[model samples]
Target: MDVAVAGGQTATTSHQLDPLQRGLLTVFRSLPRTAESVPGRPTPLVLDVGDVVVLVSGTDRGSPATRDAVLDLATDAGVVVLDDLPGRTPTGRVSLVLATHHTAATAAQHVAVRCRAPVLLPDGRCVTPGPLRLWVRPEPTLTLTRPDGRQDVVLHDLHLRDVADPDDEHPAVVDVFAHPSGSGLLLGMTDGGAGATVALSTGPRCVRVPAPTTATLDGVTRTIAPGTYRIDLAHPPLYRLHAESAARPETG
Candidate 1:
């Protein structure tokens, strides 16, 4: 017997073959099945065109037809096409949209038709992932002094969100002093001859010294690691100091 196949793609043949034999043949014909392994769900890809890079999410990578359709839509809308994105898949969020060229005006129009994912423009605008702000503020500075003519002054500039303390006094400076014999920098207070508080940039994970006793700051000279640090002060008054250290200090 013979079977008729449509589209002129399948052969018209019938033989005494079992179901297992036919299945095996079908599997053998589809070797290195790249197309079959492709995901049915949408994928994200980054396309670079000219100086602009656009991220297209929910795209069909396996199907050439679908890819061409997306590319056509993008070109018509004047959106520059970058390359495929790197790393893990985008979990349905358009985190950022940076425009290096003047293609922002057409970004929305192009992205609207091709992607079900949120569209972000070059002007820090996005259709998905809500609003995001990348703005950052400057850090604060403070000075430290000792009665033995030992002093260390450093800037305390850092990310405001990391160092802001509402419970503690606003603009408060906690001076800390350490003797040459101590292994760590100890915290001190203003009246008790304790050193001022020095805010660290690398967060509390780095060096965190509590207010130290007057004996820590009295006779032995104090040494500070040179680096930019945030100084919390009680009043808005600015203070400066000049001191020598046995170990070279870090500068910001």
Candidate 2:
């Protein structure tokens, strides 16, 4: 896709964009960027009449005419604009519209605020930061067991956080692996000061693991009897591999 970047106040490169801006652009993969005539200048908009435009500067830097022109392009060419500039009001474009107090007051229409959260698309959807991991990790490798029989699949890094937690002390920050068996669940768990008490939620019901003692599997040489286990809370978003009886039915 063709993307036009204009008016990046002092940003010499895309690296200067704030986290939200960078996170927003990730939704588009390998985009062909159209460069402006000068660095940090809105002029010579290399936009192909209808390309997606991302303006990273505030409206004050540009002349009123220039700002209006940008807005006009957004409307005329059916452009999708992610406008950090605060002066223009977007009408009918699939733009994730955000305006500043001054622009909103001046136009009595274009009202935007500095978003603390990542900017979402006009369609009211936001992109998750961990795209590649989310895509590759959860994918299972299928193994055909027997003809007319079920195939077993193994997946790595299935459950993951949307963003990495800066806090190192978080209880759920331990190394853990999960897999399912015909009889029950198996977790190769580690870490947490005295192990962890995990809380598992299925629908409205939530279950806490081993009362006081941590459930530790024997040695690397030994495997615990299936179902003789506990949930560890220190780790978070602990995913369940096999569904409960109610969630899973006899398959044809």
Off by over 4 Å in 2: 1-13, 28-88, 98-252
Give the Å error, residue 138, model 1: 26
Each prediction's RMSD to truth: 26.2, 21.5
Write candidate 2's Cα lDDT for 72-103 as tens digits: 54564456555544343334332222222222
The best candidate by lDDT is: 2
True lDDT of residue 112, candidate 1: 26
Local distance difference test, each candidate:
0.27, 0.28
Per-model TM-score, in order, reads 0.17, 0.19
Q: State the displacement of the C-alpha of residue 214, model 2, in Å, after optimal TM-score superposition.
A: 58
Number of clashes recorded per candidate: 34, 7
